[model samples]
Target chain A: MEKIEVIFYIEALSNEKKLLERAIEATVESLKGEKSIEVKDISVGDILEDEEEELLKYSGVIEARIVGSFRDVALAALRYSPAVVEVLRPGKMEISARELMEILGDVAVFMANLMEKFGGLAIYPKLDDLPEPKIGYSRDEIEAMIVEDRQILYRFVAEVYDKDEETARVNMAKALSYEGCRINKLTVQKAPNDDKKLLLAAEVLSDFETLFQLMAKYVPVALSIIEPEVIDVTAGELQNALTDISGFAQELITRPLKKQLMDRANTTFRLNP
Target chain B: MREALYWEPLEGGKVRCKLCPLNCIISEGKRGSCRVRKNIGGKLYTLNYGKVSAIGADPVEKKPLFHFWPGSCALSISSVGCNMHCRHCQNWEISQADESFPYLHDMTPEMVVAIAKRYGCESIAYTYNEPVIWYEFVLDTAKLARKEGIYNLLITNGYINEEPFRELAPYIDAMNIDIKAFSDEFYMKIARVPSAEPSRRTAVIAKKDFGIHVELTYLIIPTLNDSEEEIRAFARWVVEELGDDTPVHFSRFFPHYQLTHLPPTPLETIEMAYRVAREEGLKFVYIGNVPGHPGENTYCPRCGKPLIVRWGFKITEYNITDDGRCKYCGEMIPIAGKHAKKRYGAEWW
Candidate 1:
């Protein structure tokens, strides 16, 4: 049988006292029937500068370090360690090298399944008051944890927005009313559109109002356009308009009235002659 | 007031929370990552809205915003829940738990403003937890506080999204943000967050874009992130990105919460880190959590004279003029508000 060496990189010896003990115990148990298993505890002082690279070069050396190992049954014993579960979760590990990567991948999966089935079987030796073991999870487990955590975030956001959307829509509607009023006021002056300036202004105002009203109906969509520095107007100006209108459609729809009126006046003058 | 500040409904009965960096895409009857904002029946509501878990009057320096109102007091308040789950969180009781904690005290925005006025505080600090999680409540309080001529302060982790942060920036007068560490790996392993880029970006926006007086705090833990190289890298980044004038507080960390077994950070490490920062051309670097350390004093960057003497949170000697200039050397300091003789004692809080 080929000999394999495993290594574990334990962080904060004091923080992960319990988890480390459990890993050692499990490794010892799995190799009970094996003939060629070995385990060693390397002190922080013993690690040399080139040890990390040298370990990689050695076929049996694990990335972290072996807290414990058993002769002949080394592989089987290591498989029973609780840390294996964490190493097996989805999105956890990213293997850079192809050689022996497939075997490691299989080991990760097997460990994850074992952990899931026999939860809390591994015991962490206590250093002090810190109770939770600082278990170094496999790449997949870490990714899974991230995903799970994100799910909680998703749930929280959904609840808040879902409840407040109506009020937001109403506020948006009220805020946009100024645009329509501005347009209407412009129209009352009967400004000429000969230079096409008034006509262009009216078109711009009309577009603003239309967009604002549409935004009120669907608050998020409109906000997406306005928030990312995409909107042409300043936030203060937008806020002022929204506050004046008291309804989304009225503020937005009324903004272009003045420009539209000026254009109409210009067209009337040109046609009357 | 509504439950949350920035959120919108989406297709298929989903909602998007824009309050913080998580930008949580919440399905029906779900909550955001902070666990404060929730969606019920496709509507959003803030569970911790107006829930004041902690409140007190604290000195401005206690907020550790050394550049803003040096010798004044601010009414500090905090609700619950944070966007990130930092393993070494000092305020885990409030920032990590759900809404079931009994410490919550319900107070409206009007009440908060009134309390600040009653206490004669120069500002109101939204601290002890990530203030972004309590967006609606903070917004309301800020609006009310502004009306009463009271300034608003935020002591935060700076993990907020750009849009919502910009929206709230106008209402905030000053902020003390935790930069944590310079490495993404440290951030991910320690804070349980994927990236530190968002925090860095938020710090920039808070200082330059919003014009808020920004100070930085970094708690140095032994072995994990107290290396000389890491310290130098962090200090350099602060000087390059946040400018030399920015005050960086390198605080000593005591074992707490999940990281209790680790020994307390050595005072020598803190001193070395401070020296590294100064060598990197940082003008204002202070060491915290150690009492009577000389590093607490603010020395004139040009001339090695102690401008402000501090013992813990207390100011023993204040040598800066009302115009924020050194009285002896006449060199101007970058601090805000009027300077005076140390008016408050160390035990003011």
Candidate 2:
């Protein structure tokens, strides 16, 4: 077996140029820290504005030369979803049966996560009906909405409260539940085939910062906010995003992922994962 | 959300919960050791306030306060969370539950009182889980229940601090405190608490200081806190501290929760504990979790005759007078309140 050298071209786009640059930096740092993946050189391009999208939208790309086993490179490519993978060494690559099996498992896990997020998105049957301009919501108002909304569903992922696992699940659900916000679904199970940590999933409403504040009493895990307009596959443009060639596999992956991955693991992954 | 009864703000947006002996100093957006009390923005709140995880009309003997309105029915209610994490907890499904446990139904103090009255219960038992963790709701409900002519009983671990216990004691008419074992080591190891001394203190205070009818339950688990020495010590303590009149129930422990590897308490262990308690001068000793056993009946301390013969939680025959004197020997039994009118018919097997 020969160590493979490759150039991974990664790109990220965000309204905030700093966030975009930082994400690329973090991705490179993550790759460097990955086992069996050696970083040789790095070329980080300057942040460029996208005139077509908006005045604020910015994008950045980074090209890195890395040497690693085929398995490690494949995992990195799956995880990071780089724009391009240009092989710098090995005219022919050979992967053992075990390695191929492991790669398939990793791919299954990746698809499972992606499908879980889509399944989560599918829960909000009336996402299209959400009166959204995607504007700033005051913390107090959002809290009030979370406490008052009976129809809209939100998702929260938290670590199992080690001191008391059952209570952790209860507390997380209770923290998010209010007068109108009922915990429609809640589960506490081992963290995605990893027994060391417990994962809790709850369906309720919360703002990002307030969700962290509320969940902090139960578990010390980070939470991500899913904006209605982030990709409204429920509506016209978002639905198109799913129907397009790039999103076709994701559309097909939802049902099986929910049954196979979510049901088997008994843990829901973060939408951002 | 209900503001907790016994807590004070601390530095760095933290709060110290003084409700129980644990005295958990919780940071902002974190719960105390009980998992029911949370510190939010330097203020402590009882998260499970009015969160009823379990509620039922149970026989008063089931709370196992045999001497307190012996044959009456108590509307027992419990919220999730407990201060002490007893490894052999029977009701771990609810006791170890968090405030936000999905099955918990929202209840108010008034609603609980109404339900108890509707059920014709003479008393309301804050039970199943450690009621001390549900201090805010229990206190509020107990006070309301007391005013409604409904007796308030605490089926507790007695792991509470003096001040909070004192505050709630006035409303409590009777309590069956679970003294897990005699030694602090057993308390630390099994319940994961620093000491069982606090429970002892609470028991004493409930009996001597507040005049609350206090009974003790010592669960006998095989190979764990079931030693003759510990049981004898516990019996001696009850005799000395809680007085010879205290009705001590030596309940049998079955494999449960974290202690599934351990075997159920043998009949001999329960019998031996009963014998030891009697030898230690603790009168009114009863064996629990053993249905239809001879030791389940109340025996007269002076006459050595069965005073109240009970089959399971049902009293088959009662020999005690309305004034609470043993019918056989005329010895005054330390029974609290009058014997409640028997509610069970012959069909209640």
Candidate 3:
């Protein structure tokens, strides 16, 4: 099977650095659990350097090579462009050019859709049209609106967790809420999904930073439980393994844990059904 | 807005509000920490007086007050604003808002009492948010309700000052005060207040001084305030200061607001806290939030028999005598009701 290489260049202007960072991180994590696209996160450059000549012995199609500015990171004033997310790194044959394009669309949707979510410009193939602007708000005002949009999630949390915030931080943070309204069907801007999947993904959600941090810590802790006599763990292997284990762990730990919280939160708060 | 008490004018146009422990010093035209009281023209005024954000007939059990008229309903009412900004505030929609916060109706003291009576509620509860912040409104309503033979229950965070609380005490028959955490840092950092002293002080004043039926609620957040030592110490404090008869509820925590990153407290943690409380000499202990967890049901400490069987707010069985005693052992359960509501659903009382 031949592998394809696709590069992306995403440009956007967001006042919030955290939002932009999450846009990138979620785009990467969002690719998880896709049946068709086998997204193996490996450095194609490193793989090429190691096994470039070996591939010359075999007659195989190049499949495809697509490149553009993949995504951009703006830190205060600094910016980085062109992050290449490889779906094919000299792998076995089965994937076609059409499948590669679809996979490319998936990756592009991640960067494009996420950047668009922050009210920023998303540069992707076949998606440059803009929607009419509703209102211009400062970051704080926009934050307040987001909190307003998810009042129940936030109020329920405040009721359950009992957080005490004294000064400006809490007062300011209180302006943001995790609680959101349940809409069975809603329009999602750049979610990576087909018709049915995108519709399913359109649900109430918020705050991935803490979740990302937890995941960041969860892998090492989970892997540490393995007690490998010989320590030879790579970042990619660890992440891939974590992804595999997370699916099983989700059923065993995460969902039940959440249901426990949600059931109690709903019942005790007598939340509206 | 109505004239507010427990405030004094300072050197500047700002006035200091003495209602709760936050003791917010407000500039003219500025509200205090609770976002309910404002200092207008060197005098304080409460904007939320008689402005009810949430008013509903809720089971006293939903308030997690098992001993307080078990299976009866309380007409729960709350106006916006609270002095402390607990990040995990259950009612932040109302509690963390300014008095000008919309979504509230104009219900006078007469209307509040009348509504409770209309619903056949066992009591009128000043609850949902911290009740102490709406001092004047609760004061006026409770006084009127007392005249009408309606019990006034104040569900609070135990952060009120001595004088104002005691003055309101005679009118307030029973209260479920939330003791958020034993750590002062938890009170200061998590609840965004100066100290836990006000909470401790309020519990003492409510139970010992005023002779009000005071129940305690502690929400156990995972890795935050779920330590057995801290919980046991809190239980010990309840037994020593409040009394052995005090009903303590170790409620479970769910992810919400800014604390969504936190997972739900492990069931084992809640169970362990219950055991610690029972070990401490507290007579009535409860585990809340998790419905069908046996702990939600009331039990007689003497006979160890389930008195009022509950699943969430619904009462499934009543094993208590009509006079608030265990039907099995004939031991008094120290509850406020003449008889537990035998039928299903709320509003039976």
Give the worst 10-residue stretch by lDDT in candidate 3 chain A.
A151-160
lDDT of 2 at B58: 86
How far does residue A237 in candidate 2 sit from its true spot (Å)?
A: 40
lDDT of 3 at A201: 18
lDDT per residue for candidate 1 within A177-210, as digits (tens), equals 2111111111111125432111111111122223
Cα miss at A254, model 3 (Å)?
36
Query: Per-residue lDDT tens digits of candidate 1, residues B102-194?
Result: 557778999999999997888999999889888878888998899899999989889888988888889999989998888889888988778
Among these predicted structures, which one has the highest TM-score? 2
Q: What shift in Å separates residue A146 of candidate 1 from its native position after superposition?
A: 25
Error of 2 at A176 (Å): 10
Ten-residue stretch with the least lDDT total in model 3 chain B? B340-349
True contacts kept of each: 0.00, 0.00, 0.00
lDDT of the candidates, in the order given: 0.61, 0.71, 0.60
Q: Predicted candidate 3: interface RMSD?
A: 19.3
Model 3, range B171-275, lDDT digits (tens) per residue?
988988899999999988889987888888888888888788889999999988999999999999989988898889999999866787899999999999999
- lDDT of model 2 at position B144: 95
lDDT of 2 at A201: 69
Q: Candidate 3: what's its TM-score on chain B? A: 0.96
Backbone clashes under 3 angstroms, per model:
79, 2, 27
Better of 1 and 2 by TM-score: 2
Evaluate model 1 with DockQ and give the value: 0.01
